[model samples]
Structure formats: structure tokens, C-alpha cells
Target: MKILKINEEISIKRSVDNGTEEQRVVVKSIIERVRQDGDEALKAFTEKFDGISLVNIAVTEEEKREAYKEIDDDLLAIIQEAASNIRSFHEKQLHPSWMTTDENGTILGQKVTPLDSVGLYVPGGTAAYPSSVLMNVLPAKVAGVERIVITSPPDKKTGKLPAAVLVAAQEAGAEEIYKVGGAQAIAALAYGTETIAPVDKITGPGNIFVALAKREVFGDVDIDMIAGPSEIAVLADDTARPDEVAADLLSQAEHDIFACSVLVTPSEALAKAVAAEVEKQLLTLPRQNIASQSIENFGAIYVTDTMEEAIDTINRLAPEHLEIVTDNPMELLGKIRHAGAIFIGRNSPEPVGDYFAGPNHVLPTNGTARFSSPLNVEDFQKKSSIVFYSEKALKENGEKIAAFARLEGLEAHARAIEIRLRK
Candidate 1:
């Protein structure tokens, strides 16, 4: 990790670029084929990219039962526990449809409705994790979504999804599971095929191809977010432990070579210590090559004159994950303007939120924290405004509405309102 004195202009622009024109072009072609050829395109693409030809795209009940048989009892228990925690957290986010009656007998309210169906895209093969399946699906279930489907790539060797993924999807209350992955899977979800029905929305993280596909198909079907590489920013003071800070930084760096890991501190001594500690820890990581490349390219440690300066830098960066290790981490919470999720104190590391913590781990990345948010139950739900006016209420306000409409040169709209009135 490179260490430097804090500079506002350079620090804010440190994130690596995530776009590639080549990938977008390929994704466009894939989406077009899926939209035109339907099931045939899905089959051919699956064989071409995944190197496995599947007679059936949907995972069967027998396969799900086999997945249970293959999974260990302990792992299944863990998934259940995690799912329970996730369910409890998201259920609190559920809100009922509300209405209010005014003095004039006017009813104004909002009706909350869950999406009819949703598609979840899980990365398959080597990058698959059961936790992601839980994070993406359980929220939709909590939001009262009626149909939840999953699409993941099958393994090249065995031509099957990992048992852990299947078990997690089942536990999360998904209605159907499809053996498809990549941009092709995204396309299939956006525009339904002969076998798979279309969904109202798609949510999950995947490779660059999947991200671009989601971007292209956004208007046709709703999408959660166009996520970039993972990133973390640690705001530490002199009181913070260097070793723990180094470990937290590495947690995100190992995610991708483009992943950004940063440290902002007031103490020069702490910065040097963290830099040294990171080098020491890199020796033990299995993904050291990826982490080292990420650290070398996008990672940095800056020494600020005071905590306020550090906080200012963090706000400008607007990192995906932020860990605050200071004398009083809570004191800085009010000062933070931009961050997807904040981990306060030494005990609350980024991994806790990534796995067992009740919060969603699917967060905005690559400075998107400035405007976007973590995926939540609201993403799977839509709301409609309800307006009802009694005859007396309409009589009271009808003239003002007609006058305003006429001023806008909309005579038809004004006359429509005028018809309800005597004059």
C-alpha cells in the first residue's frame, strides 16, 4: 500500500475505472439474441460460455432434494440461522398501506404492493456463495413478493449448481431455480423465454458482463443496481490497531484487482504501521496475487493533520464500506455525509456486515455511495398514490384547478374539471 499526505483532489479520484466498451458490445449482442431466439439462444449461449449443454434449464424438485442430501448438516444449520437473521431484519422494513381522511371527506393515501415476480441472478461455478443467494432472495420474500426465481450457471465438470447454492435458494423461499448464468441469464430474466417466465425485476451481483447486461435491460425490467468492484475505506485514529486495520483493508482488496482499499488517519505513525502490517498479512492470503495487484494499483494510505480532515476526505470519496476506528466512533457518525454502510468501533468489521449482520451486503460501489443505497425490501416493492374527493371537496377546489389548468394552455384538462362543476 502506498502512503502519502492527504490531498483532496487526488484522493477523490483514486477509484479504478470499471467500464469496458468491448464487454458492452458483447452483452448487447447476447441480449438481442435472447430477445429474438428465446429458448434456443439460451441453450446455445449456455453451451458456448458455460461449456455445458442442458436439456432442461430449470432445476427440478428431485435435484433440490439431492442438494439437501449432498449438503452437510452443519452447513445447512448455518444457512438456516443466517436466513432467520436476514428475515427478521427485513421484516421490520415491511410497512402497511396507509390512508388519511381530511376534514372535507377527502381520502389521500398510498397503497403498497409487492412485485408480482422477481428474478435473482447468482454467480455460479467458482465465484458462487450461498450467502449472496440469501442476501438477494430473503428481502423479496419479506416484501411479500409472490414469485421469486433464481438463475445460476451450472458447473462445467458436473453440469450442476453447487449444493450450497441450491440449499440456500430453497431456504430463502424461492419458487423456481434455473441453471443459467452470466449476461445470458440476465437477458433471459429481462425478457422471458419459452420455458422461463419474465420477472418484474432482477436483483443480484455478477461479473462485468452481467453488470452491463443489467444496464442495457434496465427499462424493460427493473434492476437493483449496476454494481462495480468492491471497495472499503477505513477511517482510523492513533488509538486504532494497525493489524486489524490491515486485515479489514485486505478483505475488500482480495475481491478484485480493480477493488479500492483506502485508509485515512491523523497519525503518520499509524499509517506506516498499517502499511507494514498489510505487507505482512498479504503473505498468508490465498488471493494474495489479486490483493497485491489491487493494493498496488488502487490502494492508498493518507496522513491527515486532524480527524476533521480525514472525515472530509471520506465524505468526498463516498466509499462503499467505511470502518471508523477512533476514540469515539459514534461521535463521527453524524459528521459522515456519504457511505453505503458504516462499521463503528473495532469489533464491527466489514465482514460482519457481509455475512452475519442483519444489514444487506449488496451495496453501491465505485463512489456510487454518494447517491445510491444498499438493496432493501423497498427495492422489491412498488407504491401507488390514492386520491378520492367527495362531491363537496371537489366543489370547494374545482375552480382553482380549472383556473390553473387553463393558465397552462390545457383547455381540455380545464374543461374536464369544468364539467364536474355547474358554471
Candidate 2:
């Protein structure tokens, strides 16, 4: 980690990966093939990319039973507990369709409707993320989505989705699971194949190809944001532990080489200590190579003149994950205007939110926290603006509406209002 003085011009923005031209072309072609050939295209792509032949694209009940067996009792229990926590949290976010009537007999409100179906794309390769399975599915489940489907690549050796992922999906109340991944999986989700029905929205994280595929099919079907690499920024003071901060930073760093880990603090000594501790801890991480590359490329420690300045720097960066570790972290909470998720105090580490804690871990990345938000129950639901115009109300306001429409040069809109007024 490089230590530097915080300046007004300081920025932590990384270039968003919109994918190369070649990758975009490939994704466009894949989506087209899936649209045309449907299930066969999915199978062919699975065999070509995942290197496995699938007699069935869907995960069978027997396969799910086997997956349950592979998970130990303790781990299964933990997954269930995590699912319960996530469900309980998201259920609080559910809002009922509401309306209000005026004295003139006009009714207006929002009608909240859960999506008919949703597809969660879980990444599978070097690691298994049952946590992501819970994070993505449980929110949709809480939003009252009828069909919550999961699509993850099967392991090359066993030709099955990770046992933990399967178990987590089941615990999260999602029964529809598919064994497909990459751009092909995205395409299958967007355009219904013979086996997999198309969903109203798609959510989850994946590789560059998957991101590109989501981008390609965005307008046809709603998608969660095009996520970038992971990021974490810790705003700490001298009271914070250097080793603990370093470990928390490394947690995001190990996710990818492009992952960003930064520490902003007023204490120069604390900054130096954390930088040294990060180096010391890097040697022990199993994903040391990935973490090291991430640290070398994107990690930094900034020494600010005051805690206020540090908070300002953090807001400017709008990091995905922010940890406020200071003498009084709560006092600074209201000052933080950005960040996808804020973990206050030393005890509330980022991992707690990532796994056990109720908050959704699917967060906006690459400085998108300034405008976007975390994946939550709201993402799985849509709102329809309810408008019931009574004859008396329209008679009172129709001329004003018509004049407003005429001012916009939309005669048809004016006529529509005038026609209603005449009725």
C-alpha cells in the first residue's frame, strides 16, 4: 500500500469495464444464438465453455439431495440461519399497494407489484459463494416474486453446482436451479430456452463475459446494475487496530486483481502501521497472488489533516464498502453521504454484512454508490402509478390539462383530455 497526503484532486475511480469490442461482439452473438436455437444453443455453449455435456440443463431433485448430503450439518444450519436473517431483514422493506382518494373523487397512489419471475446468476469457478446465493434469492423471495430461479456453472469434474450454493438456494426458498453459467447462462435467462423460462429481471455477479451479456440484453429484460470489481475504504483513527483494518481490506482485495482497498485516516502513524500490517498479512492469505496484485495496483493509504477531511475524501470516492473505525464512529455516520454500505465501529467488519448480517451484500461498485444502491427487496418489485380520474375531477381540471398538453405541441394528448372532458 502506498501512503500519500489527501489532496482536493484525489480520486479512487477505476475505469468501468464495459468489455472490449471482441467480447461485446461475442456476447451479442451468443444472445442471438440463444434467441434462435433456444435450448440447443444453451447446451452447446455449456459444453464449449464449461466443458461438460448435460443431459438436463436443470438441476434434478436427486442432484439437490446429493448436494445436501455433501454439506455438513453445522454448515447447513448456518446457511439456514443466514437465510432467515436475510429474509427477516428484506421482509421489512416490503410495501403494500396504496391509494388515496380526493374530495373530488380522484384516486392516486402507487401499486407495488413483485416481478413475475427473477433469475439469479451465481458465479462458479475457483470458489463457491453460497452467501451470494442467499443475498440474491432471498430479496426476491421477500418481495413476493413467484419464481426465483438460480443459474450457476456446474463444476467441471462432477458436473454439478457447488454443494454449498445448492444448499443455500434451497434455504433461501428458491427451488428452480439451473446448471449453466457465463454469457450463455445470461442469454438463457434473458430469452427463454426450451427448458428455462425467461425472467422479468436478472440479478447477481459474474465474470466480464457475464457482465457484457447482461449489458447486451438489458433493454429487453431488466437487469441489476453492471457490477465492477469489489472495493473497500476504511476511515480510521489512531484508536483503530492496524492488523484488523489490514485484514478487512484484504478481504475485498482477495476477491479480484482489480479490487480496490483504501484506508483514509488523519493519523499518519496509523496509516503507516496499516500499510506495514497489510504487507505482513498478505503473506498468509491463500489468495496472496490475487490480493498482492490488487494491493499493488489499487491499494492506498491517505493521511488527512482531520477526520472531517477524511470523511470528505471517502464521500468523493464513493467506495462500495466503507468501514468507519474511529474513537467515535457513530458521530461521523451522518456526514457520510456516499458508499454502498457503511460498517461502523471496529466490530462491524465488512464480512459481517457480506455473510451473516441481514444487509444485502450485492452492492454497487466502481464509484456507482454516488447514484446507485445495494441489491434489495425494491429491486425485485415494480411500482405502477395508480390514476383514477373521476368525471367531476376531469371536468374541473380538463381545460388546464388540455392547454398544458397543447403548449407541448402534443395535439393528440390535448384531444385525449378534451375528449374525456366532453364525455
Candidate 3:
């Protein structure tokens, strides 16, 4: 980790990867093939990309049962408990459809409706992430999405999806699991195939091809976001533990080679201590190669003149994951204006939120935390504005509405109101 003195405004925003022209062209072709060839295209792509021949695109009940058998009883209980916690947390975010009536008999309100269907893409290949399955699927289930589907690549050797991924999806209440991945899976989710029906929205993370495929089918179907690399920033003082801080930073670093882990503090001694600790810990990390490259290229520790300046720098960074590990973390909570998720004190590490802390781990990355948010139940639901004007209310306000419409030079709109008023 490199240590530097903060002299001016700092930004950790990485340039968004929009994919190369060749990748975009390939994604477009894949989507068109799925639309034209349907299930056959899906099978062909699966065989080509995933190295598996699938007699059935969808996972059977027997397969799910076998998956449960593969997972240990203790792990199964843990998954179930995490599911309960996640469900409970998101259930609090639900709001009922509401309306209000005026004395003149006019009614106005917003109707909240869950999406009819949703597709969650779980990344699979070198590794499986059951936590991701829980984070993505449980929110939709909580939001009352009627049909939740999951698509993940199958392991080449076993020709089966990871048992853990399967178990997590089922525990999260998603029964429709498909063994497909990459751009083709995204296409199938966006536009229906013979086996997989189209969804109203798609949510999850994948490789560059998956991201490009999502971008290609965006207007046709809603997507959660174009997520960037993972990021973590720690704002700490002298009281913070150096070893714990270093471990928290490496947790994000091991995710990707581009993942960023930064530390902002006013304590020069703590800064040097954490920098040393990070290097020592990285020597024995399991993903040392990846984490080393990430730390080498994107990791940094900035020494600020004051804690206020440190907070200002963190606000400018607007990191995806932030940890405030000062002596009085709560006192500075209100000063933080931007962060996808804030872990307070040394006890609340970033992975706690990632796995079992009940908050969605799918958060905004790069500088998007400035304006975006973590994946939530609301992302699975849509809003429709309701309007009703009584005869008396229309007569009272129709002329004013017509005038407002005409002010915009929309004659047809004004006539629509005036003709109703004439009646």
C-alpha cells in the first residue's frame, strides 16, 4: 500500500467499461439469435460457452433435492437463518398502495405493484457464490414478485450447477433455476425462449459479456445497474486497530484485480501501521496474486491534516463500502453524505453486510454511491400514479387545466380537457 499526503480534491472513480465494439457486436448477435432461434440457440450457446450438453434447461425437483443432500445439515440451517434475517429486514421496507380523497370527491395516490416476474443471474464458473443468490433472490421474493427465476453456468466437470447455489436459490424461494449463463442467459431472461419465459426485470452480476448483454436488452427489460468494480474505503483515527483495518481492505481487494481499497485518516502513525499490516497480511492471503495486483494498482493510504478533511475526502470518493473505525464512530455518522453501505466501528466489517448482516451486498460501486443505492425491495417493485377527478372537481378546475395545456402549445391535450368540461 502506498501512503500519500492529501493536498487537493481526491477522486477514486474508475472509468466505466462499456465493452469493446467486438463484444457489443457479439452480445447483439447473441440476443438476436435467442429471439430468432429460441431454445435451440440457448442450447447451442450453452454447449459452446459452458462446455455442457443440457437435455433439460430447467433444474428438476430431483436435482434440487440432491443439491440439498450435498450441502451439510449445519450449512443448510445457516442458509435458512440468513434467509430469515434478510426477509425480515426487507419486509420492513414494504409499503402498501395508498390513496386520499378530497372534499370535492377527487382521489389521488400511488399504487405500488411488484413486478410480474424477475430473473436473477448468479455468476458461476471458477467459483460459486451462494451469498449472492440469497442477496438477489430474497429481495424480489420479499417484494412479492410472482415468478423469480435464476440462471447460472454449470460446472464443466459435473455438468451441474453448484449445489450451494441451488440450495441458496431454493431457500430464497426461487424454484425456477436454469443451468445457463453468459450473454445467452441474459438474452433468454430479457426475451423469452421456449423453456425460459421473459422477465419484467433482470438483477445480478456477471462478467463483461453479461454486463454488455444487460446493456443491450435494457429498454426491452429493466436491469438493476451496470455495476463497476468493488471498492472499500476506511475512515479511521489512531484508536482503530491496524490489523482489522487491513483485513477489511483486503476483503474487497480479493474480489477483482481492479478492486480498490483505500484508507483515509489523520493519524500518521496509524496510517503507517495499517500500510505495514496490509503488506504482511497479503503475503499469506489465499488470493494473494489477485489481491496483490489490486493493492499494488489501486490501493492507497492518504494522510489528512484533520479528521474533518479526512471525512471530506471520503465524501468525495463516495466509496461503495465505507468503514468508520474511529473512537467515536457514531458522532461522525451524520457527516457522511455518500456511501453505499457504512460499517460503523471496528466490529462491523464489510463482509458482515456481505453475508449475514441482513443488508443487501449488491451495492453501487465506483463513485455511483454518490447518487445510487444498495439493491432493495423497491428495486423489485414499480409505482403507478393513480388519479381520479369527480364531475364537480373537473368543472371547477377544467378551464385552468386547459389553459396550462395550451401554454405548452399542445392543442389536442387542451381539447381533451375542454371537451370533457363541455359535457
Say which candidate scores most in lDDT.
3
lDDT of 3 at 293: 97
Candidate 2 lDDT, 5-30, residue by residue in tens: 97777776777578788888998899
lDDT sort, best first:
3, 2, 1
The residue pairs in collision within model 2 are none
> Per-model C-alpha lDDT, please?
0.91, 0.92, 0.93
Model 1 agreement with the true structure over 31-115: per-residue lDDT tens digits: 9999899989999999998899998899988899999999999989989998999889999898999999999999999999999
What TM-score would you give candidate 2 relative to the actual structure? Answer: 0.98
lDDT of prediction 3: 0.93
| Model 1 TM-score, 2 decimals | 0.97
Q: TM-score of each candidate? A: 0.97, 0.98, 0.98
lDDT tens readout by residue for model 3, 10-101: 77777656888998999999999999998999999989987888999998899999998999999999999988888889888899999999
Candidate 3, which ten residues in sequence have the lowest lDDT sum? 7-16
lDDT preference between candidates 1 and 3, better one: 3
